[model samples]
Target: MKIQEIREIIKLVDGSSIDEFSYEYEGVKVKMKKNGLGNAQQPSQTAIQEPQFANAEEMPTTKPAKETELIKPVIEEQTADLPGADSDYHKILSPMVGTFYESPSPDEAAYVQVGTKVTADQIVSIVEAMKLFNEIEAEVDGEIAEILVKDGQLVEYGQPLFLVKAN
Candidate 1:
């Protein structure tokens, strides 16, 4: 394209809050995203994450390529702490990739808020993706200490959905 056209495109992107724009034509795709802009300004972006789930029968339980023979002597000691000490924390991770809906919408009440009691299989929120609504349930029974997402926010896979005080 012409230099003036490219400059205009850049200007179009720079003037909007939409991060990451892509244009494709004639087998050429141009993608640009606003990076470090939020960092330079305020920190209001709410991070969203969704959980990934595969069929239990299809999941594999194996470690690949342990490239650490030099620490053979410390292997046993290292193995002792492998599980990590904070394994006790109750984490409610997202179960799907979609837009996180804290409530039905901006005018509705959130399903459950911080300090709310929840049990296993309780519907905590809904994720809207691909024109479908997936209800996210609680995997454990506990009081919610913090919710990791806001209403109408786009979420990614395997993001922290909430922090629960385990019972």
Candidate 2:
């Protein structure tokens, strides 16, 4: 399908009360789902699978199994013990699903480190999505207490990126 058609479908889904939608034509498949907040729907996954079979015999007898186990290793537990664990700390959350970048570039210094004081608008990190790098700001004025995610780590939307001791 054309990009315009896909965009129109997204708009339609977003404005309507539908929670999920799916479409398949030819070899292309598109699936969209809302985040359960009754907000705009996001395209969770889009795939184009074209079967290249010269004859019925060329097709495989069984369908490939989904590798759900491989995804488990990507999620790691955060440190359980830290200084001021009992105290109130603000969490800097990722605004979107993307790769977390500590620095603007490989050779550049990180935007902030543990114990680095930051203001509410200070740029703390970058999240690259769809080739666009979005600078994430420290939403609360505080001292960086812990960096939760490693550089180049894949982050999910609303995932905690940093812990901050509010000033």
Candidate 3:
């Protein structure tokens, strides 16, 4: 019912595999739904109802006009003249929606850069979601050909972060 409680619920939903959640207490109602990856038909929505008391003696009234859509973050695709065909490269994608960091921290050097050789299990970057920093690994042994996303950029689930030319 409180703002902090609502935020906690949102954090839990964002970090988990659950696609939808709804809660109702007294006359207050809350609903949250996540859009399916690459599913253009359904857009993500989170609705919260604020109780409005018409008079001291009457119960709170809920209105549908209070519902609002949460705007998703969008990152423009960076264009680059790649050396080879698309199939010749391996894409390192973000596993969750979060802020992408090229390095562990601001003062630290990046895990990898263009032309840096990397192994399949090497941590190439970090994606911070719900205040939890997640290390993203290069799933294939390759040389970094291009860095697609910018550092500290807000990225979506399954968005490409880098293009590596497989060794």
Candidate 4:
């Protein structure tokens, strides 16, 4: 669907009593929900649009934005400390949706732990997706301030996985 059509749907949904709306065209999907004062309450509508894939034959053969941007730096003005960590830490976010593992194998030691010094190219964790194990690296020079996810945890794209304090 066109951007104009999507905007129109959002307007219509916002003015009506409907609290939620979802539409799919070909391969594109759109979801909208109303957020209220709290988790249980419903308020103004929110819209989320999926990729614009009209058909299987026209599907893009490139990696999604989330998958290719591993090592992207997340700058936070004020990040809370974890135990013995410093507050001025850069967050390392996941590049794709997958299962997080701390080690190459269960019997081996973790790639890195809290307080472990790390360089830009050091592998910190492995994220498994579609039967492929992807090694996630520390994109900056720092100490492994904190590990945000546990082993085998299901993590989403862009989710924070580690907090690193620059050396």
Per-candidate TM-scores read 0.48, 0.54, 0.56, 0.51
Considering only N, C-alpha and C atoms within 3 Å, which residue pairs clash in candidate 2? none
- Ten contiguous residues minimizing lDDT sum, candidate 4: 66-75
Backbone clashes in candidate 4 total 2
Give the per-residue lDDT of model 3 (tens digit) for 3-115.
Answer: 43455577677777888888777655677777666877766544444443344443422233312222132222332443452888988888987789999989999999999
Cα lDDT tens digits for candidate 1, 1-167:
22223334555666767766776554434456555544657632212111122444432242211113212333344334332225554666666656799876678788899889999888888888767888888889888777867787656556667777778
Q: Which residue pairs does candidate 3 place in steric collision? A: none
**How would you encode candidate 2's per-residue C-alpha lDDT over 86-146 as one tens digit per residue?**
5579888888767899999999999999999999999999998778999999999989998
Candidate 2 regions with alpha-carbon error over 4 angstroms: 1-87
Which candidate leads the pack in TM-score? 3
Full candidate order by TM-score, most accurate first: 3, 2, 4, 1
The candidate scoring highest on lDDT is 3
> What's the lDDT for candidate 1?
0.60
Q: Which of 3 and 4 is the better model by lDDT?
A: 3
TM-score of 4: 0.51
